[model samples]
Target: MSLDDKNTLAVEGGSPVRNTLLPYGHQCIDEDDIKAVVDVLRSDWLTTGPKVAEFEKRFAEMVGAKYAVAVNSGTAALHAAAFAAGIGPGDEVIATPMTFAASANCVLYCGGRPVFGDVEADTLLLDPSSVESKVSPKTKAIIAVDYAGQPCDYDALKKLSDEHGLILIADACHALGATYKNRKVGTLADMTVFSFHPVKHITTGEGGMVVTDNPDFAVRLCAFRNHGITADHRQREAEGSWFYEMAELGYNYRLPDINCALGLSQLKKLDKFVARRRQIAALYDSAFADMPALFSLAQRDDRKSSYHLYVVRLNLSKLNASRQQVFGALRAENIGVNVHYIPVYWHPYYNKLGYGKGLCPVAEKAYEEIVTLPLFPAMSDRDTGDVIKAVKKVLRVYAE
Candidate 1:
C-alpha cells in the first residue's frame, strides 16, 4: 500500500480498484420502511392524514423544537420559511454561496434578493464578518446554511441578525441531527428547515420540514404549505364546517401521509444511521490525516455533525494534475467521487441575474478542489476500504 508500489492507475489502462462504482450517497431502506408505506396505502386517509401530524410531532421533539410543519421537499420548506419571514420585493437576504442553489433560490421564491456571502477558508461555512458586510437596510433576513451537516457559527450569526433586526433562518437541510454549542440545529434559529431526501440522514421518499419556537411562524408555515388556507381538510372536517379561506398566496407544498409514515419509520433509525456515517467519516479522517495532498474540512470541537456528506479538499499545489483529472482518476477506479457544489452564483441563471465571479473567493477556490466521497449507513467496512485504497492510489499517482 506504499506510494512506491508502482501500481498503474486505472485511468491509465490498468485494472480498477472495484468492478462496480460506489455511489457518493444512498438511501438505506428496510422491511419496516416498506411496511410503513404499505400500511399507509391500506388506510382510509392517504395524503392529508394523521400520519403527517404524528411525524411532525416526533421530528420536532427529536430536535427540541416547539413546532414543525411538513412540506413536500426541502426546497419547499425553505420557500415556506422565507414566505413566513415576510420576504418581499426589494428585500435582501444574506446567504452563503457554498451550498445547493436551493438555499438561495428559496429567497428568490419569496421575491427577495439573495446577497452572496463568502465562507471561512477552513470550514467552508458562512463567515459572520462577511455577512455583516453584506447587511443593509434592505436586508430582511440571514439564511445561514449548515454546510455538509455541520451547523454554522450560529452564536455570531445570531448576534448579527439581532443587531440588524433581521430574521435568522437556519437552512439545516444538511444538519437535521447536528448540534451547535450544545443546542440542536432546529432550536438554534428563528426558523430551521430539514430535508428527508433519499440521500439525507433520513428519507420519506421526498419530504421536508420547518421547525420553530415561534407559534406565529409555525402557523404561517402550516398555512403556506397548504395553499395559504386558514384550515386544512382535516381541520375543516373536524369542525364539521366546509368553509375555508385563502388569506395569502401560497404553494401546494404539503407532504402526503404515506411519505410521513415512511418518514416516521425512518426517523426511528436516524440515530443509528448518523452513527454509522460518523464512523465512516472517522475512518476517512484517519486515512487522510497524514496525507499532505488531501485533507478533510475543519470541524469545530464544540459541534457534532450528522455527516450527510464526507468531503475532502485536494491540495492542488502538491498534485501534478488538476481537480478534474484526479476526479476522473477516482471515477476510473470505480469510486463515485463527486463535487459537493459549485458556488450558487456561478450558475448561468444567477449569472444572467448579474451575479458574477469573485463574489466569494474562498468558496470559489474551495469548489475547485473539494470532492465528496462514498458514505452511507449501508456501506460495509470492505466498501470503505476499497474507497480509501482507490483514493490513496489515485492521489499517489498524481502526487508531486
Candidate 2:
C-alpha cells in the first residue's frame, strides 16, 4: 500500500485508496435533530407557527443581525433580498462569476441584469477593483459571494458601495459561522443570505434565511415570502379579522415550521459543526502545502472560513493531465471530487443572453483547474486521510 507506487493508481486498473466513495459534502444528523422535527410534527402548527418566529429570532441573535426572515431555499433568499433592494427593469447588479448560477440569476428574477465581475487569482473572492470597474449608472447593487465559506474583503467593498450609493448584499450561503475582522458575516453587508441545505453548516431539510439590520428590508422580505401580503394568517386570527390584501406580487416562498424546527436544532450545534469543518480543512492544507501538482485556495489572516468546500487548484503545468482527466481519476479512486462552479456567464442560458467567453479572465481560468474535495462535519479523520491519499496518489501518477 505504498502511496508512491504509480501502479496503484485506480485509473490504471489498480485498487482504489478506499472501497467506498467519499462524498464531497454530507449532512450530520443526530437524535436531537430528529426529536426536534418530531416535536413539531406532534404539534398543531405545521406551516407558519411559533417555531418559525423562534428560529428567526435565535438565528438573528446568533449572527448579530437585527432582523431575520426565513424562506424556502437559498434562491428564494436571494430573490427576496433583490426585491427588498428595489431592483427593477434597466437596473444592474455586479456579482462574481465564480459562484452558483443562482447568485446571478436572482438579479434577473427581479428584471435586472447581472454584470459579471472577476475574482482574485488566489482567493476566488469577488475582486473589489473589478466590481468598481463594472459599476455604471445602471448599477443598483452588488452581490458579494463568500465563495468557499471565506468572507470577502468587506471594508473595501463597503467603501465602494457607499461611494456609489448602492446596496451591498452578501451571498453567505456557504459562510454560516464565518467571520471577517472579528465580525460575523450576517452583519457585514446591508443584507446577508444563508442556506440550510443538508450539505450546508446546518440543515433544515430545505430552507434559507435573510438577515438584515434595516427594518424596511425586513418588512419587504417578510411580505415577499408570503405572496406580498401585508399580514399573515396568524396576525389576522389574532386581530379577529379575516380580511387581507396583497399589496404587490410575490412568491410562495415560506419555509415550513417543520423545517424551521430542524434548523433551530441544527443551529445549536453550528459552532461545533464549523469547528470540525475547519479542522478538516487544516488537515488538507497541511497535506497539500508541499504538493507541487496542486494548491489550495488562499485564506486571509483576518477572516476565518467555515470551509464548506476544501477546493484546490491543480497546477496543470506541473502535471501531464488536464483537470477533467484528474477529476475522472479521482472519481475512479472512489474520491468524489467535484468542480465548485463553471463561470456563470459561460452557461448556455447566459451565453444566449450575449455574455461571451473571456468576460472574467481570472474566474474563467480558475474554473479550468479547480476541484472541490470532501469537506463536512461528519467526516472522520480516516475519511480525510483517504481523500488526501487518493488525491496525492492520483496527482502523483500524472505529475511531470
Off by over 4 Å in 1: 1-6
Deviation from native of the Cα of residue 58 in model 1, angstroms: 0.4
C-alpha RMSD of candidate 2: 1.5
Tens digit of per-residue lDDT, candidate 2, span 247-346? 9899999999999999999999999999999999999999999999899999999999999888999999999999999999999989999899999999
Q: Could you tell me the lDDT of residue 387 within candidate 2?
A: 94
Best by lDDT: 2
Which runs of model 2 end up more than 4 angstroms from their true locations? 1-6
TM-score of 1: 0.98
The per-residue C-alpha lDDT of model 1 at residue 116 equals 93
User: Per-residue CA lDDT of candidate 1, range 8-74, in tens?
Assistant: 8888878889999999999999999999999999999799899999999999999999999999999
lDDT of 2: 0.95
